[model samples]
Target: KEGRKLEQTARLIQKTAEAKNMPATKRAALNMQKLGRRMAQGRMDKKQAMVRMAQLTKQMQAQQRQLAQQAGQAALGGGKSLSQAGQQLAAALQSQAAGGQNAQGASKMQGAHSAGSKSTGEKSGANGGNKPAGQNAGHGFNVPGRNKPGDKPPQNALHGAAQPTPEMKQIAQALQQNNAQTLSEQLRQLARKAETGQMTPQQQQQAAQDLQKLADALQGTGMPETQQHAQAAAQAMAHGDKQTAAAEMRKAADAAEREAQQQQDAQGMQDAQNSLQDSQGEMAGAQDPGDIPDGPSGQGQGQKPGGKGQGQTGPPEYGGEGNGGRGGGRGKPNTTYHKGQKPSHKIRQKPGYGADAPHWLDPHFDPAKNPRYAKLYFGKPRTAGPSQAGPTRKTRPGEDTGPVRSTVPYYNSVVSARKTAENAMDREDIPPAYKKNVADYFNSLQPQSPPPPASSGAGGTKP
Candidate 1:
């Protein structure tokens, strides 16, 4: 009966020791405590109790070894499994503590626990050290374990000392081609890679240079807002501010798109204007001069047939009879006069000369009839009339105060040129200093009001 009872107690202790919820070491400790109680109660002999305690201790040690093996496997996998491995190691140590029976056993358990802890620490360090600098810093905490004693610290990719990469060269070429959209996209990608610690130091530096080049190209495009954004993005990249750089790159792309649209619109307008001008010129050239109406002077109208002097076909001679007369008549009639015969009508002197003219003004000395007179008075005199009281100022032909004709098309052309220049000056991409000069040039071209016609004084005298 005692043997059967002892067997039942040993089986119960084993079952309790292996409970999943309770740690193996705790179970072993409980088992030892229970065995001591059984011995004190005289329910078991010391030899049998010792034997059962030894078996429990071996079982706990075996469970601990299994946990250590699992930890080693987790560590080798290089994942969150590593943390799991650490938890398992802790569990194994506790299990060892529970199974310890004597001082020697306690010492062995401590040594095993230390070994398990050391292995977990080394696995964690290895995992941290292998990660990229960007990834390591991304979590907001700098783990000192990332830097092993024999490992060199990772360098920043965007440091000034890094050299350009082949990708950077390609990006620069794209910039030179004025491919703002493409360059902006490329820059964004590079910045993202940089943020994720995927770029090498050289590649990061190259990306920064490429961004600067793109900014310069945008500046050339003459879009101020876009250029400003591009420059900001470049500066951000240089400072390793990938987030800012990415945002600025997007802005630059938008600005570039707007500028391109504006250019297209301007080009379309220019083409339409050119086409209209060309069509108008063609229409004007197609018209015949013979189709025009005769002037109010009856000049260029066909002569009347069968009229008194209609058949005269010879070219008219200069200074001929009635050739240069001001009266609106075709030709003067020829008349034969006898000597001493009274003229039918009194002969009037030429319009400009006076009857009391000097002796040099012979009766036949008509300015229209004489080449010398015509040469002497090459142009009409400004002082020809008596009421012309101003000094005889020599004037060029066509200087008379005739009605001025307005050249609307010519004015429009000038205005268009000035407007184009002004628009260029208003562009953000243009240098501020150069913009002032551009504005000045266009302003100078604009027609200014004639200086308020110099205000007249009260007495009508010039101020």
Candidate 2:
């Protein structure tokens, strides 16, 4: 369990690394408050203020674009699993004639499809056969990777990375608009004019109006009240009301700081930091013992210098008699040969005879001693349960009403099977009547649409 926790923590670290660099964005948000304060105090020159404004806008726009791109990729990845589901369903339906194999294949496919759907919804991607990355965010806690029945799961470093929040796409769309981009350009132009001492009164008024528009764009970012004060400050500037503008800007700056603190509190950022610190302290004081023997081949307290002196430390072909010796016993096959030397004779064994052989070349083996040898089963030994003292009692009245139990067929399978049958109907080898019957069967299995509401004059029920 400790090892598992370490693995999960490592995956969580990788996931956090893959997440958008929110710290940079958050710092930029906080810096806006500082910028507002400098403006309110008249501490910075107009040219310097404008340059800083332009830089901050560009930084925010870049971050928004990156978030938008990530969200888009995750959304596109979701549809991919549905396509894979269709393929699995089609293959299962087509293999119905294969008896038990078909049943087993269908059952496994259905399980994987359901698991994948759940993983997609929860953004955990714990299912093994799931495609790599972008379909989900964080890994499920202690959930083992689930591959197909007989297949190995594909490895991915970023598999733990979850989908971006919906707010990311919304915020990006608002901040990356033409007006936001134009506002940045306008700031740069205003800065250049102020630097050259060519800034006109009308131009200053226009810059204030542009700033208000930028603040309006920011209103979509869940800080409407805070940004509203920024808009008021901009309006005051446009009317040549420096005192009111300064006061409003100062208020806006304070509001932004409060908002940031509230956000950190609500998200439990401080708690997470504290927990991480505690974990680090514990890890720092821990140490591993070096004296324990690792395995049979390890050095400490062993039978010999090379341990048990298995074939691992012996000649490939001719080894001393002991457990795991290449001469006999349970060692690996003798594959090493001199450059020009070959065995004088070849040894052959019947099919499955090698299953009990220590080395494939040795066919004279005892199956009774081989743990992996195929065994015949008579039947399962039955054990009797406790006998009741009296006659069987009828189930209680409420027992039957506990819950409805039924096997609900998946809609994707129905759709896929119908599609496959339709394709088969187009083939010339199949009879038209048979094709029609198959089509009718699949069509009946689909969910039916509800009937439309009756019109006022068409026998509609009175409210």
Q: Which candidate is the best by TM-score?
A: 1
| TM-score of candidate 1 against the unseen true structure | 0.29
Looking at model 1, residue 18 earns an lDDT score of: 48
Query: What does the lDDT read for residue 313 in candidate 1?
Result: 12
Per-residue lDDT tens digits for candidate 1, residues 219-280, read 42335566688688778878877778778877766765554333333333233223323333
lDDT tens digits, residues 1-463, model 2? Answer: 2223333443444344335333533444355546656655667744575566567656655554443343222122222221232233234323322443444455456546755675463554343435543222222212224333444433221221122112222323433331223223333343444345453444445445544544544544433444677688678768876556556655654554444333333223222233334433444454432122111110011122222322221121221111221122222223334245443222222211111222322222223443322221011112222211110111222243233322333343567767776776675223342345356556546644434566789678642
Error of 1 at 249 (Å): 1.0
Task: Give, for candidate 1, the lowest lDDT window spanning 10 residues.
Answer: 293-302
Model 2 spans with C-alpha error above 4 angstroms: 1-208, 219-226, 235-241, 250-463
Colliding residue pairs in candidate 2 = 128-146, 136-162, 137-161, 137-162
At residue 15, candidate 2 shows an lDDT of 43
Screening candidate 1 with a backbone cut-off below 3 angstroms (N, C-alpha, C), the clashing residue pairs are 25-98, 224-428, 224-429
- Judge candidate 1 at residue 373 and give its lDDT: 40
| Candidate 1 regions with alpha-carbon error over 4 angstroms | 1-162, 165-168, 194-197, 200-206, 289-463
